[model samples]
Target: MARASDVFTEGDADLKVLEVKSWLKSRGVRDFEPVSLFADQLTKDTVAAIEKLADTCTANKSSSAIKKAIVKGIPRQAVLKPSHAVYRLQNQRFALGDRVTMVQDSGGVPLSVKGVVIGLNTKSIDVVWDVPFMSGVTIGDRCSEYRGSTVEFDSCLNLTNPQFVASTNPKAPATSIPNTPFKPRSGPYPAVRPAPGHIGASGFRPAPARFVVSSLDLINSVL
Candidate 1:
Protein backbone atom coordinates (compact mmCIF):
# COMPACT_ATOMS: atom_id res chain seq x y z
CA MET A 1 0.00 0.00 0.00
CA ALA A 2 1.35 3.41 -0.88
CA ARG A 3 1.47 5.94 1.92
CA ALA A 4 -1.23 8.61 1.64
CA SER A 5 1.49 11.22 1.35
CA ASP A 6 3.32 9.23 -1.35
CA VAL A 7 0.11 8.86 -3.32
CA PHE A 8 -0.62 12.57 -3.11
CA THR A 9 2.93 13.57 -4.05
CA GLU A 10 3.15 11.22 -7.04
CA GLY A 11 3.94 12.71 -10.51
CA ASP A 12 6.13 15.46 -8.97
CA ALA A 13 3.40 18.05 -9.34
CA ASP A 14 2.48 20.70 -6.78
CA LEU A 15 -0.94 21.86 -5.61
CA LYS A 16 -2.21 24.98 -3.87
CA VAL A 17 -4.03 24.55 -0.57
CA LEU A 18 -7.13 26.13 -2.12
CA GLU A 19 -7.00 23.61 -4.95
CA VAL A 20 -6.76 20.77 -2.43
CA LYS A 21 -9.85 22.07 -0.62
CA SER A 22 -11.71 22.32 -3.89
CA TRP A 23 -10.81 18.70 -4.70
CA LEU A 24 -12.02 17.55 -1.27
CA LYS A 25 -15.34 19.30 -1.81
CA SER A 26 -15.73 17.65 -5.18
CA ARG A 27 -15.09 14.29 -3.53
CA GLY A 28 -18.13 14.86 -1.23
CA VAL A 29 -15.81 15.85 1.59
CA ARG A 30 -16.93 19.23 2.82
CA ASP A 31 -15.79 19.14 6.43
CA PHE A 32 -12.00 19.46 6.11
CA GLU A 33 -10.32 22.63 7.44
CA PRO A 34 -7.83 24.20 5.06
CA VAL A 35 -4.35 24.88 6.34
CA SER A 36 -3.49 28.63 6.38
CA LEU A 37 -0.32 28.14 4.41
CA PHE A 38 1.30 30.02 1.54
CA ALA A 39 -0.30 29.73 -1.93
CA ASP A 40 3.11 28.42 -3.03
CA GLN A 41 4.01 25.90 -0.37
CA LEU A 42 6.68 23.22 -0.27
CA THR A 43 5.97 19.74 -1.69
CA LYS A 44 5.87 18.25 1.82
CA ASP A 45 3.24 20.76 2.98
CA THR A 46 1.06 20.01 -0.01
CA VAL A 47 1.30 16.27 0.68
CA ALA A 48 0.49 16.84 4.35
CA ALA A 49 -2.61 18.80 3.40
CA ILE A 50 -3.76 16.02 1.10
CA GLU A 51 -3.08 13.34 3.74
CA LYS A 52 -5.18 15.25 6.27
CA LEU A 53 -7.99 15.43 3.75
CA ALA A 54 -7.56 11.70 3.14
CA ASP A 55 -7.89 11.05 6.88
CA THR A 56 -11.19 12.92 6.89
CA CYS A 57 -12.37 10.92 3.89
CA THR A 58 -11.40 7.70 5.64
CA ALA A 59 -13.41 8.75 8.66
CA ASN A 60 -16.37 9.32 6.37
CA LYS A 61 -15.85 5.96 4.60
CA SER A 62 -14.88 7.66 1.35
CA SER A 63 -11.31 6.36 1.17
CA SER A 64 -11.46 5.57 -2.55
CA ALA A 65 -12.11 9.20 -3.35
CA ILE A 66 -8.61 10.21 -2.28
CA LYS A 67 -7.09 8.39 -5.28
CA LYS A 68 -9.62 10.04 -7.57
CA ALA A 69 -8.59 13.46 -6.31
CA ILE A 70 -4.93 12.61 -6.88
CA VAL A 71 -5.66 11.49 -10.44
CA LYS A 72 -7.55 14.67 -11.34
CA GLY A 73 -5.30 17.13 -9.46
CA ILE A 74 -1.98 15.94 -10.80
CA PRO A 75 -1.19 17.56 -14.16
CA ARG A 76 1.47 14.98 -15.03
CA GLN A 77 0.83 11.24 -15.47
CA ALA A 78 0.50 9.55 -12.10
CA VAL A 79 1.12 5.82 -11.73
CA LEU A 80 -0.82 3.78 -9.25
CA LYS A 81 1.60 2.13 -6.81
CA PRO A 82 2.16 -1.52 -7.71
CA SER A 83 1.38 -2.54 -4.10
CA HIS A 84 -1.79 -0.47 -4.06
CA ALA A 85 -4.71 -1.99 -2.19
CA VAL A 86 -6.60 -2.90 -5.37
CA TYR A 87 -3.66 -4.94 -6.67
CA ARG A 88 -2.89 -6.34 -3.22
CA LEU A 89 -6.44 -7.63 -2.94
CA GLN A 90 -5.94 -9.46 -6.23
CA ASN A 91 -2.48 -10.78 -5.32
CA GLN A 92 -3.39 -11.75 -1.76
CA ARG A 93 -6.59 -13.49 -2.87
CA PHE A 94 -8.38 -12.73 0.40
CA ALA A 95 -11.58 -10.77 0.63
CA LEU A 96 -13.99 -9.11 3.03
CA GLY A 97 -15.45 -11.45 5.65
CA ASP A 98 -12.77 -14.06 5.07
CA ARG A 99 -11.28 -15.88 8.05
CA VAL A 100 -7.51 -15.43 8.02
CA THR A 101 -4.68 -16.15 10.45
CA MET A 102 -1.53 -14.13 10.51
CA VAL A 103 1.40 -16.45 9.77
CA GLN A 104 4.07 -14.02 10.95
CA ASP A 105 4.06 -11.14 13.41
CA SER A 106 4.03 -7.66 11.94
CA GLY A 107 4.83 -4.37 13.65
CA GLY A 108 3.37 -4.79 17.11
CA VAL A 109 0.53 -7.02 15.94
CA PRO A 110 1.31 -10.50 17.28
CA LEU A 111 1.32 -13.76 15.40
CA SER A 112 -2.07 -15.48 14.85
CA VAL A 113 -3.92 -12.16 14.77
CA LYS A 114 -7.23 -12.57 13.00
CA GLY A 115 -9.61 -10.04 11.55
CA VAL A 116 -12.33 -9.34 8.99
CA VAL A 117 -11.61 -6.94 6.14
CA ILE A 118 -13.81 -3.89 6.61
CA GLY A 119 -12.18 -1.40 4.27
CA LEU A 120 -9.19 -1.04 1.96
CA ASN A 121 -7.42 1.76 0.12
CA THR A 122 -4.05 2.64 -1.38
CA LYS A 123 -2.87 3.20 2.17
CA SER A 124 -3.89 0.06 4.05
CA ILE A 125 -6.47 -2.62 4.69
CA ASP A 126 -8.78 -1.60 7.53
CA VAL A 127 -9.62 -4.57 9.69
CA VAL A 128 -11.64 -5.08 12.80
CA TRP A 129 -8.83 -6.85 14.63
CA ASP A 130 -9.98 -9.87 16.58
CA VAL A 131 -8.04 -8.50 19.53
CA PRO A 132 -9.12 -4.97 20.24
CA PHE A 133 -6.66 -2.20 21.11
CA MET A 134 -5.99 -1.52 24.78
CA SER A 135 -5.83 1.62 26.90
CA GLY A 136 -2.71 3.83 26.86
CA VAL A 137 -1.74 2.13 23.58
CA THR A 138 -3.11 3.34 20.27
CA ILE A 139 -3.37 0.84 17.46
CA GLY A 140 -4.36 3.73 15.19
CA ASP A 141 -7.45 2.02 13.76
CA ARG A 142 -6.56 -1.65 13.10
CA CYS A 143 -4.94 -0.91 9.75
CA SER A 144 -2.00 -2.71 8.18
CA GLU A 145 1.28 -0.99 7.47
CA TYR A 146 1.68 0.46 3.98
CA ARG A 147 0.28 -1.73 1.17
CA GLY A 148 -1.19 -4.29 3.61
CA SER A 149 2.00 -6.34 3.50
CA THR A 150 2.14 -6.54 7.28
CA VAL A 151 -1.44 -7.69 7.86
CA GLU A 152 -1.92 -10.31 5.14
CA PHE A 153 -2.64 -13.81 6.41
CA ASP A 154 -3.18 -17.33 5.23
CA SER A 155 -6.69 -17.61 3.76
CA CYS A 156 -6.56 -21.38 4.23
CA LEU A 157 -5.87 -23.39 7.37
CA ASN A 158 -2.59 -25.27 7.88
CA LEU A 159 -4.00 -28.77 8.26
CA THR A 160 -5.07 -29.65 4.74
CA ASN A 161 -5.60 -28.24 1.26
CA PRO A 162 -9.21 -27.50 0.35
CA GLN A 163 -11.19 -30.11 -1.56
CA PHE A 164 -14.11 -29.80 -3.96
CA VAL A 165 -17.40 -31.34 -2.84
CA ALA A 166 -20.82 -31.86 -4.42
CA SER A 167 -23.77 -29.83 -3.23
CA THR A 168 -26.27 -31.73 -1.08
CA ASN A 169 -29.44 -30.05 -2.36
CA PRO A 170 -31.89 -32.84 -3.16
CA LYS A 171 -34.17 -30.53 -5.12
CA ALA A 172 -31.39 -29.88 -7.64
CA PRO A 173 -30.39 -33.30 -8.85
CA ALA A 174 -27.08 -33.83 -10.59
CA THR A 175 -27.52 -34.32 -14.32
CA SER A 176 -25.11 -35.75 -16.90
CA ILE A 177 -25.23 -37.16 -20.43
CA PRO A 178 -25.87 -40.95 -20.38
CA ASN A 179 -23.04 -43.33 -21.40
CA THR A 180 -25.01 -45.32 -24.01
CA PRO A 181 -22.81 -46.65 -26.82
CA PHE A 182 -23.28 -44.91 -30.15
CA LYS A 183 -21.21 -44.37 -33.34
CA PRO A 184 -20.64 -40.98 -34.97
CA ARG A 185 -21.00 -40.64 -38.75
CA SER A 186 -17.66 -41.24 -40.58
CA GLY A 187 -18.47 -38.56 -43.19
CA PRO A 188 -20.27 -35.29 -43.45
CA TYR A 189 -24.05 -35.33 -43.10
CA PRO A 190 -25.83 -36.09 -46.39
CA ALA A 191 -27.05 -32.89 -48.04
CA VAL A 192 -30.81 -32.58 -48.47
CA ARG A 193 -31.62 -32.92 -52.21
CA PRO A 194 -33.79 -30.21 -53.65
CA ALA A 195 -37.13 -31.22 -55.12
CA PRO A 196 -37.13 -31.91 -58.91
CA GLY A 197 -36.81 -28.68 -60.95
CA HIS A 198 -36.65 -26.71 -57.68
CA ILE A 199 -33.76 -24.65 -56.33
CA GLY A 200 -30.84 -26.53 -54.78
CA ALA A 201 -30.26 -26.58 -50.97
CA SER A 202 -27.86 -23.60 -51.41
CA GLY A 203 -30.76 -21.63 -52.91
CA PHE A 204 -28.55 -20.75 -55.93
CA ARG A 205 -30.27 -20.28 -59.32
CA PRO A 206 -28.89 -19.18 -62.69
CA ALA A 207 -30.42 -16.14 -64.38
CA PRO A 208 -33.27 -16.88 -66.82
CA ALA A 209 -32.38 -17.17 -70.54
CA ARG A 210 -34.38 -14.05 -71.40
CA PHE A 211 -32.06 -11.96 -69.17
CA VAL A 212 -28.83 -13.69 -70.41
CA VAL A 213 -26.70 -12.02 -73.11
CA SER A 214 -23.50 -13.00 -74.96
CA SER A 215 -20.87 -10.22 -75.47
CA LEU A 216 -20.18 -11.08 -79.18
CA ASP A 217 -23.93 -11.35 -80.07
CA LEU A 218 -24.69 -8.10 -78.23
CA ILE A 219 -21.82 -6.29 -80.02
CA ASN A 220 -23.04 -7.63 -83.43
CA SER A 221 -26.65 -6.60 -82.63
CA VAL A 222 -25.46 -3.10 -81.63
CA LEU A 223 -23.38 -2.81 -84.84
Candidate 2:
Protein backbone atom coordinates (compact mmCIF):
# COMPACT_ATOMS: atom_id res chain seq x y z
CA MET A 1 0.00 0.00 0.00
CA ALA A 2 1.27 3.46 -0.92
CA ARG A 3 1.93 5.61 2.17
CA ALA A 4 0.24 9.03 2.61
CA SER A 5 3.63 10.78 2.12
CA ASP A 6 4.15 8.83 -1.14
CA VAL A 7 0.68 10.00 -2.30
CA PHE A 8 1.49 13.61 -1.37
CA THR A 9 4.90 13.54 -3.11
CA GLU A 10 3.39 12.12 -6.31
CA GLY A 11 0.28 14.34 -6.30
CA ASP A 12 1.75 17.66 -5.17
CA ALA A 13 4.81 18.03 -7.39
CA ASP A 14 5.20 21.75 -6.62
CA LEU A 15 5.47 21.33 -2.85
CA LYS A 16 8.44 23.19 -1.32
CA VAL A 17 10.39 23.14 1.94
CA LEU A 18 8.88 26.45 3.09
CA GLU A 19 5.39 25.01 2.67
CA VAL A 20 6.34 22.06 4.88
CA LYS A 21 7.61 24.38 7.58
CA SER A 22 4.45 26.48 7.33
CA TRP A 23 2.29 23.36 7.58
CA LEU A 24 4.19 22.11 10.66
CA LYS A 25 3.88 25.53 12.32
CA SER A 26 0.15 25.78 11.58
CA ARG A 27 -0.53 22.39 13.15
CA GLY A 28 1.78 23.12 16.17
CA VAL A 29 3.90 20.10 15.20
CA ARG A 30 6.85 20.64 17.57
CA ASP A 31 9.00 17.63 16.54
CA PHE A 32 10.27 19.26 13.32
CA GLU A 33 14.02 18.69 13.69
CA PRO A 34 14.13 15.58 11.45
CA VAL A 35 11.86 17.13 8.86
CA SER A 36 13.80 20.41 8.82
CA LEU A 37 17.14 18.57 8.53
CA PHE A 38 16.08 16.74 5.32
CA ALA A 39 13.66 19.34 3.97
CA ASP A 40 15.51 19.65 0.63
CA GLN A 41 15.13 15.97 -0.25
CA LEU A 42 12.00 14.52 1.41
CA THR A 43 12.59 10.86 0.56
CA LYS A 44 10.19 8.04 1.53
CA ASP A 45 12.09 7.49 4.80
CA THR A 46 12.05 11.20 5.64
CA VAL A 47 8.33 11.43 4.88
CA ALA A 48 7.68 8.36 7.08
CA ALA A 49 9.57 10.02 9.90
CA ILE A 50 7.55 13.22 9.43
CA GLU A 51 4.31 11.18 9.41
CA LYS A 52 5.34 9.57 12.71
CA LEU A 53 6.05 13.01 14.20
CA ALA A 54 2.72 14.34 12.92
CA ASP A 55 0.93 11.35 14.48
CA THR A 56 2.36 12.29 17.90
CA CYS A 57 1.19 15.93 17.42
CA THR A 58 -2.41 15.10 16.40
CA ALA A 59 -3.67 11.71 17.51
CA ASN A 60 -7.13 11.94 15.92
CA LYS A 61 -6.12 13.13 12.40
CA SER A 62 -5.15 10.60 9.72
CA SER A 63 -2.08 10.92 7.44
CA SER A 64 -4.42 12.04 4.65
CA ALA A 65 -5.73 14.81 6.89
CA ILE A 66 -2.14 15.95 7.53
CA LYS A 67 -1.57 16.10 3.76
CA LYS A 68 -4.66 18.28 3.37
CA ALA A 69 -3.48 20.56 6.19
CA ILE A 70 -0.09 20.96 4.51
CA VAL A 71 -1.75 21.82 1.19
CA LYS A 72 -3.90 24.41 2.93
CA GLY A 73 -0.84 25.96 4.54
CA ILE A 74 0.58 27.00 1.17
CA PRO A 75 0.96 30.79 1.02
CA ARG A 76 -1.22 32.69 -1.41
CA GLN A 77 0.25 34.64 -4.35
CA ALA A 78 -1.37 37.89 -3.22
CA VAL A 79 0.60 37.84 0.04
CA LEU A 80 3.50 39.80 -1.49
CA LYS A 81 6.19 41.81 0.24
CA PRO A 82 6.16 45.64 0.14
CA SER A 83 9.41 45.68 -1.85
CA HIS A 84 7.94 43.29 -4.42
CA ALA A 85 4.92 45.54 -4.92
CA VAL A 86 7.16 48.57 -5.34
CA TYR A 87 9.38 46.67 -7.77
CA ARG A 88 6.34 45.79 -9.87
CA LEU A 89 5.22 49.44 -9.92
CA GLN A 90 8.68 50.57 -10.93
CA ASN A 91 8.75 48.09 -13.82
CA GLN A 92 5.56 49.69 -15.20
CA ARG A 93 7.67 52.74 -16.30
CA PHE A 94 5.03 55.29 -15.32
CA ALA A 95 6.42 58.56 -16.70
CA LEU A 96 5.40 62.22 -16.66
CA GLY A 97 2.37 63.16 -18.82
CA ASP A 98 0.86 59.67 -18.57
CA ARG A 99 -2.85 59.76 -17.79
CA VAL A 100 -3.91 57.44 -14.97
CA THR A 101 -7.08 56.85 -12.96
CA MET A 102 -6.99 56.56 -9.19
CA VAL A 103 -9.41 54.04 -7.78
CA GLN A 104 -10.90 55.04 -4.39
CA ASP A 105 -13.19 53.12 -2.02
CA SER A 106 -12.22 49.98 -3.89
CA GLY A 107 -13.59 47.49 -1.40
CA GLY A 108 -17.16 48.68 -0.85
CA VAL A 109 -17.68 51.11 -3.72
CA PRO A 110 -15.20 51.91 -6.50
CA LEU A 111 -14.52 55.47 -7.54
CA SER A 112 -12.18 56.29 -10.43
CA VAL A 113 -10.57 59.71 -10.34
CA LYS A 114 -8.69 60.80 -13.48
CA GLY A 115 -5.29 62.46 -13.21
CA VAL A 116 -2.08 63.16 -15.09
CA VAL A 117 1.25 61.73 -14.01
CA ILE A 118 3.33 64.81 -13.24
CA GLY A 119 6.23 63.41 -11.23
CA LEU A 120 7.76 60.13 -10.05
CA ASN A 121 9.89 59.12 -7.08
CA THR A 122 11.54 55.95 -5.83
CA LYS A 123 8.65 55.17 -3.48
CA SER A 124 5.63 56.98 -5.04
CA ILE A 125 4.20 58.85 -8.00
CA ASP A 126 2.87 62.41 -8.13
CA VAL A 127 -0.49 62.90 -9.82
CA VAL A 128 -2.38 66.07 -10.68
CA TRP A 129 -6.05 65.23 -10.29
CA ASP A 130 -8.63 66.79 -12.55
CA VAL A 131 -10.79 67.36 -9.48
CA PRO A 132 -10.20 68.77 -6.02
CA PHE A 133 -10.82 67.14 -2.66
CA MET A 134 -14.36 67.53 -1.40
CA SER A 135 -16.42 66.43 1.60
CA GLY A 136 -18.62 63.35 1.37
CA VAL A 137 -17.58 62.65 -2.20
CA THR A 138 -18.30 59.13 -3.35
CA ILE A 139 -18.14 57.00 -6.52
CA GLY A 140 -21.09 58.87 -7.98
CA ASP A 141 -19.08 62.08 -7.96
CA ARG A 142 -16.55 60.90 -10.55
CA CYS A 143 -17.86 63.37 -13.10
CA SER A 144 -17.91 66.31 -10.70
CA GLU A 145 -15.20 68.90 -11.41
CA TYR A 146 -12.99 70.77 -8.99
CA ARG A 147 -9.81 72.84 -8.91
CA GLY A 148 -6.99 70.59 -10.12
CA SER A 149 -4.47 69.65 -7.46
CA THR A 150 -1.57 67.27 -6.97
CA VAL A 151 -1.65 64.11 -4.84
CA GLU A 152 0.82 61.44 -3.80
CA PHE A 153 0.41 57.88 -5.09
CA ASP A 154 -0.16 56.37 -1.63
CA SER A 155 -2.55 59.12 -0.50
CA CYS A 156 -4.74 59.12 -3.64
CA LEU A 157 -5.07 55.38 -4.16
CA ASN A 158 -3.37 52.01 -3.86
CA LEU A 159 -0.32 51.80 -6.11
CA THR A 160 -1.43 48.44 -7.44
CA ASN A 161 -4.67 49.74 -8.95
CA PRO A 162 -3.64 52.82 -10.91
CA GLN A 163 -5.43 52.29 -14.23
CA PHE A 164 -3.54 53.53 -17.24
CA VAL A 165 -5.40 55.99 -19.48
CA ALA A 166 -3.08 57.37 -22.16
CA SER A 167 0.52 58.59 -22.36
CA THR A 168 0.92 62.06 -23.91
CA ASN A 169 3.69 64.36 -25.10
CA PRO A 170 3.54 68.18 -25.18
CA LYS A 171 4.64 68.18 -28.82
CA ALA A 172 2.29 65.36 -29.88
CA PRO A 173 -0.23 66.47 -32.46
CA ALA A 174 -3.13 64.90 -30.60
CA THR A 175 -2.52 67.11 -27.54
CA SER A 176 -1.95 70.35 -29.51
CA ILE A 177 -4.71 72.99 -29.32
CA PRO A 178 -6.69 73.62 -32.48
CA ASN A 179 -8.12 76.81 -34.13
CA THR A 180 -4.81 78.72 -33.84
CA PRO A 181 -4.14 80.51 -37.11
CA PHE A 182 -0.65 80.34 -38.68
CA LYS A 183 1.28 83.60 -39.05
CA PRO A 184 2.03 84.96 -42.54
CA ARG A 185 5.63 85.73 -43.67
CA SER A 186 7.07 88.74 -45.54
CA GLY A 187 10.84 88.10 -46.30
CA PRO A 188 12.10 87.29 -49.85
CA TYR A 189 12.10 83.55 -48.89
CA PRO A 190 8.71 83.78 -47.09
CA ALA A 191 6.55 80.64 -47.28
CA VAL A 192 3.48 82.91 -47.58
CA ARG A 193 3.43 86.66 -48.10
CA PRO A 194 2.12 88.79 -45.19
CA ALA A 195 -1.37 90.29 -45.43
CA PRO A 196 -1.37 93.97 -46.54
CA GLY A 197 -1.64 95.49 -43.01
CA HIS A 198 0.53 92.94 -41.11
CA ILE A 199 3.84 93.60 -42.92
CA GLY A 200 6.65 95.05 -40.74
CA ALA A 201 9.53 97.46 -41.72
CA SER A 202 12.00 94.57 -41.47
CA GLY A 203 9.86 92.73 -44.10
CA PHE A 204 8.82 90.03 -41.57
CA ARG A 205 5.25 89.46 -40.41
CA PRO A 206 4.41 89.40 -36.70
CA ALA A 207 3.11 86.08 -35.34
CA PRO A 208 -0.64 85.78 -35.01
CA ALA A 209 -2.24 85.94 -31.53
CA ARG A 210 -2.45 82.48 -30.00
CA PHE A 211 -5.94 81.50 -28.80
CA VAL A 212 -5.47 79.49 -25.61
CA VAL A 213 -8.37 77.18 -24.74
CA SER A 214 -9.22 76.25 -21.17
CA SER A 215 -9.21 72.56 -20.24
CA LEU A 216 -12.74 72.90 -18.79
CA ASP A 217 -13.95 74.24 -22.13
CA LEU A 218 -12.41 71.26 -23.88
CA ILE A 219 -14.14 68.84 -21.52
CA ASN A 220 -17.45 70.67 -21.86
CA SER A 221 -17.18 70.55 -25.64
CA VAL A 222 -16.69 66.77 -25.56
CA LEU A 223 -19.75 66.33 -23.38
User: What TM value does model 2 have?
Assistant: 0.22
**Candidate 2 Cα RMSD after full superposition onto the native fold (Å):** 32.6
Model 2 error, position 98 (Å) = 0.4
Each model's TM-score, in the order given? Answer: 0.24, 0.22
Cα lDDT, model 2, residue 220: 100
lDDT of 2 by residue, 1-223 (tens): 6545664665553465458768988998864433222112223343334334434544665666644333343233323333343332222444455566554343221246655454344444444444445531222221223323333343342343343222233343332222332122222354454577666446655688999999999999999
RMSD of each: 24.4, 32.6
- Indicate which candidate wins on TM-score: 1
> Which stretches of model 1 miss by more than 4 angstroms?
1-90, 122-124, 134-223
lDDT per residue for candidate 1 within 1-223, as digits (tens), equals 5544564665433454457768888998775433223211123333334335545544676556656433243321122232342222232433334444444432544445544443333323334444433321222322323312224322221212112122344354443322332221122323366678887756557987686679998999999
Candidate 2 at 110: error in angstroms?
8.5
| Model 2 poorest 10 in a row by lDDT | 135-144
